[model samples]
Target: MFDFIRNHKRLMLILLALLIVPGLGLVGVQGFRGFFDNGANVAEVSGSKITRQEYDALLKEQLERMREMFGGAVNTAAVDTPVLRQILLDSLIQQRILADEAKRQRLSASDEAVRKTILEIPALGALRKSDGSIDTEKYHDLLAKQGMTPEQFDARVRRSLAIAQIGDSIEASALAPKSSAAQLAQLSMQQREMRELVLHPLDYSAEVKPTEEQLKQYYDTHQKEFETPETATISYAILSAEILAASITPSEEELKKAYQDNLATYQTAKQVRASHILIATPKADTVASAKAKAEALLAQLRKQPGQFAEMARNESQDPGSAARGGDLGYFAAGMMVKPFEEAAFKLKPNEISGLVQSDFGYHIIKVTEIKPAQTRPLSEVKQTLLSDLKKQQATQRFAAAADQFSNLVYEQTNSLTPAAEKFNLVVQTATVARQAMPAPTAVPALANPQFLAAVFESETLKGKHNTAAIEVGDNTLIAAHVTAHKPASVLPFETVKQGVQQKVTLLQAAELTRKAGEEKLASLQQSKSTAGFSPVIKLSRAGARGLTPAAVSAIFKADAEQLPQYVSAILDGGVYAIYRVESLSPLPELEPQRLTALQQQLAQLTGQLELNAYLASLRARSKVKIYATENAAASE
Candidate 1:
């Protein structure tokens, strides 16, 4: 049950939005019911409609999340596809279905459960007062950040709890039989000894020469690659949080007060390194038997303290740390459940504790080390505090300035100079395209799709006027005035002839290399020859050595039941590889911790399958309508 303590903060945000914020849905339902029937209704569950506006908003949020998850390396075009739109719409419909089902089943959580769950969540720890009660003011501020009120947040949390019950019931019923788990584990750990011979593309490059006709044909078929994108020279103005922050100066007294207000954030808590032996109290085990088993282990440890690690390795039920003799590593206060944390902190280094009862089970902990708490002096963190204060002030300033900036650009229309003068921003000029080229000198804000779209709008381009202000970053806005434009045009074949010949030659070379590799595989299968193969090496799903996943998969997919199996894999970088499977063997008995982890993984997989099937059944029983062209619900 304490596993919830390890839940990620991102998941908590997703959970808070279980079925859309109550505030948004309430407004939309109250005012847009008429519009829903004709204009923008994307889906509906029961009597509630999912508006196209809501769908688009959710899609944008999801894409932003993907961009954040990949550190902005995500390709927007690749992610924002028709398939993704349908998938997101289906997901929204499922969430609606679950919410309706919760209400139909009258699955609202008790006020006490809601209170307890909110307090238990580590992500919300900052919202708790010193007296162990919810900090009402802070809680309100937190909800307000998500555009929700306290009542709305509580209702959402309650609904999330109720929806969780549906999943919990299904997962609790899922059982992965021990035999199935072991068989799966065995297959995963099964090893193959193999040798490979590769055909390099370079080896065949001399055999295939590209003619001018072939190069022209290739160029004709792929003209888009040879065309220059439409480009424009524009003057743009940017109003950003950093620029605002640069102009603000905070007083020393203000900085000190800010530092004092967030003192907890600057203090390092005391940490403990400990090892534990847990006797888990599953539902199948009686409390008395479980505690009795824990007591027995404690008694044995008392008689032979040096045998703690051995006993823990043999008996601990926690899969995560059992292999390292139950070492839990270092953890600060609030990291562990209350009962366990209290007992652990009371112990001295090298001292052992008696059985301590917890939600998970009974834990016998041995403290190995302790790090004293520390507090940084104000002088040490003054610069950081000053920077944060300025940023805070700038954010507030930007919130007000953003509106004025938008108005100024929209009203002026002819030039960005007026807004630039008002905000003290420079009217910078850059050459840009509908798609920003990847170059060192390219302007980052110009790469934003919304900003670029505004720049390329028909009205803005034809009139040589300023585009409407668009948000390009956090508290950052951009407006551009088009000065010159160039239309897209294809390059002559003569201009790209050399590049086309290199491409055609590479394609031909790769094909020849693949064909040669296939012939080698056939020869090896018939002659049982190892003349051209590398030294034998072992491979398993768990360990692919340095080979690519595709190569490893091909090696395993070969008929390994019989010896001397041959397989071919076309790898990236225009290389083809042929492998000879020499032998196969089952791994030795798995390490105790690995075995436990595998069993847990198998159980989770089984539970996930069960959950998916349950959702499918729920969808079938509910009335879901998709107004989009795909109409995903009709297929279901």
Candidate 2:
């Protein structure tokens, strides 16, 4: 929620979108304790409390939007961190600060504007009357359901519009100098032609061999590299929602009752399997001519029912289905346009309709089949109904079962047997190697980082208390006790002697390669010509020579004042390469499109700078109060 504050240009823009501004993100309400009652608010803007309820709703909405933006690839459990929470809180606070400042500057939106904006919202405008005016009663009811009075909702809309108006004016006024565009283009497009000599670790490896003393010294200095990771064995009382749901049996009576209750949804509507012959309005012809052509085609279809498909193929303008005899398949009422629908529904099986006109032009339809409205019996939908019922019942039972699981585990402290017996759950056991070895994904219970920390904490490992129930996934909870812990220890010298020798040899080879590269660079700097180097060609700042990002960065960072510059850096696999800059070239001119892009980029930069400065000045002068921060709230 508060993440947008770092981006000053978009802060006000996003706030104006979701309101009272619903984009205002966080002030942790659940565990947060403050001077004010419940400490549910992060700040007060002109004495208006920004409640935790508002913060939570906005954050949740934004989080869902983010997941949606990523095509639902984001794992929700991994990213709900305190850092993100604080970022949201900051954004909310920033919005409040700006809103309060808007009030001070007498930025006001008229009531008419507020009303117009309100009516534009689908939730408010969906109940519009014939006069293109809002249904006042429904609008009031909508606000009531959202826990807001008319005045409160109205004032919020008015405030948001005013602030948005101010933001747009400020952004539009931002100017980018013409000279800056040319200069920026030059910096981004500069190219250097150079040739580099590459050296590999294998080249120096044959010359270097480590002595016994060197291997021993390397092993002792880098002892951490050889340390054996700690391992732990844990016992868990697993309360699985899936397992519980599968085991439970709902009586036949309950299943029947649920089926009956959902009977309305199983009722199918009246529909016809249809095919049409359409004479679409041609680009060169008028609608009247198209209708006349459709009438002539309909007359041919009426004379020979079997030739309807061939005639549709030869003359029908509805290309989507013309190849397949213009079959529109099965469609219920309300699926087709008014004139077309009225004509098609009045026909019986094997019956043909005359020319019917709609927005798509004229059509002649045939009723291939018709299905009257009917209710689906229990036999047809039993399995689906049973599955849905079982899930619903299991969800209801799990809530009560989870409370008992949490309580029994906490009350008994030393054992999981009582809770295991109560839920008919098994006390499962597993051994994990260190914190990083058995990845969190491998074990379902320890999927949460907090659970992993608790398992290794002094209380659970040494004090022998059961770790509190930690939520790892949707409808999943886990608690564990450390059965045994192996402390981390270093491997003895003899145990890793061969590995240590290999490390010492590589280290020596890498140093030799670096030294050789530096010498080569110095030699190249002295000689301006390509005496010993390979052919050098130009590579731009865009780096199109298959150069690694690191190599490109190194090249650009070199001192540009000197011609024929030289620099060397260690590459991947203990290799080294020396890059020599032969010459630098700048762009000739910025094209119209490039100039426009640069101008927009410059304008956005100036807007951000201006907005940030404005926010800073507002912060300095205002009585901005933060009752609680995301960090302080999360620590509890």
Candidate 3:
């Protein structure tokens, strides 16, 4: 593959320009301008426009990455929605805006800085040589596949560094006031000395029973609460790939043929395990100067091959492998760049190559051990091959069978009986509601949502015919017919009358409880008596195990303008508690650790405020246009 690239260098360069020019020089590259100008653009920042083509490619990359990261756990429906589309567009616009600003400010990263940043990045680090320096040629190929050029990648990296500088300056300028910190610490540490009078709702339940007239009135006014939704009883027939696959058997001749047809996959390529010490020369040093330095070191290595590891340890320029004496673990042929791979694979075990020139610079490589090519026998992989063959046969049959399945259901119209009989599938029945409630992050299922929709479609709900085959999951389809349709209706008043009466009585009791508590608290404040008050003790904001946080907050919010302040609130489990704050305490100094934590929290808040302010200014100054027409095109 690479030989074509070397032989037709000009043709490869043209292909790279066609694929990568739009991204690197979007506005200025005339050859690609007509494509973006005539077509729609999703968003534009400053002078740089993110065309529809760019947005779609980025979103596709993000989706594929998500699928790889999540495997079977990925929810394609959720991830493919308009919200994710908008988010990706916004991120691209933001990067362009920052890049524009970096150019305006004359901020730049040297070639050495760009190379260092690339090596530090985890994704790019995978292409590093044995001595730790990045493989320049592999990096270029990766960028080409990503629809970007090396210059574009460098620009993006420079913009990122500039943005980080802005964030750092904002965070450094943020300082939390010491007095404000002290105040927060005091509030967080404050404690309260209080007592409560609890009133249970059940205590008033018996004295406030409702009349027959009231029960009837409530049932009439609140009919929606007692109504039943429309429902349907339907029968469905389904065909599954797994069930079909189990019924078919592959003969030994078939599995053997499959193995022979795809023989390359059954073989493993030759692997070479070699270590190297690289002399650094990534566009910084002249080729002649670098060659002279590399050949001088080559002379020493040839004199003493046994001292290769010691010489590599003291002199190698690759940071990643230098510490380990340039030990690169086992690798395959295509894993490394073409030039490096060719030189490494040519030499016998322990044979050192003379100075070799490549993109990164000249290098003297020592060949280590090589494992010969290998191929597995049919006996070893027979089981796996058999399973694959069965699945392939099952899939073809399922496709041909599916068209007939859909046709039978639609043609029969009245029932699922004909389709079920033809495929020998069981006709399953279910009673489901009209609502197709969403299961946002789950695999679409047979009964939960689409089934609800199938039974509720206008014609089916009216008992006209069965639903056409609906694909609810991979290699699975269902066709449902509504046998019985029931419209929504209100329940009989007689059935729910007793329950309604019980609810009315409880509501009346709660009102009575509130009024009684208010009257008793007023009398207590005036009389200054502990008549029936519960025992009082001091407690912090974090109340006892039984008391809730809401109850604690309510206690602190009580009227504290005078002595013996009173406040009441309904607590959980249908009880009302009236609190009396007998006295107030002055603020006290907090522990050293508590004070430190409080200060750190305040500092974080201040930093967030600064960051938001900075971003707001950025958005206000930048000319960001999101074209509605382009976004609509994307939606379609």
Per-residue lDDT of candidate 2, residues 439-512 (tens digit):
43545555455567668888888888898777654456788888899888999999999899778888899888
Model 3: number of backbone collisions: 0
Cα lDDT tens digits for candidate 3, 13-87: 323323222343222212112222355676667657777766655644554557678884544334444455566
Roughly what TM-score does model 2 have, to 2 decimal places?
Answer: 0.72
User: How many clashing residue pairs appear in each of the predictions shown?
Assistant: 0, 5, 0
lDDT of 1 by residue, 348-416 (tens): 998999999987888999999999898898999999999999999999899789999999999998988
Lowest-scoring 10 consecutive residues by lDDT in candidate 3? 26-35
Error of 3 at 602 (Å): 4.0
Span of 10 residues, lowest total lDDT, candidate 1: 26-35
Q: Between candidates 1 and 2, name the one with more favorable TM-score.
A: 2
Worst 10 residues of 2 by lDDT: 27-36
RMSD of each: 10.8, 7.0, 10.9
Best by TM-score: 2
TM-score, per-candidate, Cα-based:
0.67, 0.72, 0.61
Error of 1 at 465 (Å): 2.2
Choose 1 or 3, whichever is better by lDDT: 1
